[model samples]
Target: MSVYVGNLSYQATQDGLTQAFSEYGTVKRVQLPTDRETGRMRGFAFVEMGTDAEEDAAIEALDGAEWMGRDLKVNKAKPREDRGSSQGGWDNRGGSRRY
Candidate 1:
């Protein structure tokens, strides 16, 4: 399982996250998502550790811990919700078209 790290600095880097989490245990992977259009960091990331224990330790140690001038929100990553449709818009308009 991976840990969800939020409220991160936009300048935060994958290597930086790995290094920070490594203090508790081995960091397996770090995913820092970016805005597609802006091509900028989304101020959050997902971190996968070598073991559940390591994840827990990192979460416990890092949650609300200030890093990079921002308080981090760290916890067990929740499964991504399925939005069903990739195309997003006003899908429910009762068949009415408005300008």
Candidate 2:
């Protein structure tokens, strides 16, 4: 099972999330996004689980729990669809470019 964690603090780290969820059950993986340039926390993350029971346990334990001085929002994650860039849309240009 996979879970999505959101509303995280910039100080939150992958290790911190793992440790926090370890109390409930084993954590398969924890992924925290960071700024591309600054390399700082992006304020959100995702967690992978080995079992549904563990996933539930983790969500119940971590959701609404404060971490890094911020309340965590943990929930099941849906598969992400690839979002293309809007610049490729012809509608925005009103037609095809001749040049």
Top candidate on TM-score is: 1
lDDT string for model 2 (22-67, tens) is 7877888998878899988887888887788989988998899887
Model 2 TM-score?
0.78
lDDT of residue 75 for candidate 1: 99
Q: What TM-score, over all chains together, does every model reach?
A: 0.86, 0.78
RMSD from true fold, candidate 2: 3.8
Q: What lDDT is reached at residue 6 by model 1?
A: 100
Per-candidate count of clashing residue pairs (backbone under 3 Å)? 0, 0
Local distance difference test, candidate 2:
0.82
Candidate 1 structure quality by residue, lDDT tens digits, 1-99: 899999999989999999999998999899999999999999999999999999999999999999999999999999998965555445565553334
Number of the predicted model whose lDDT against the real structure is largest: 1
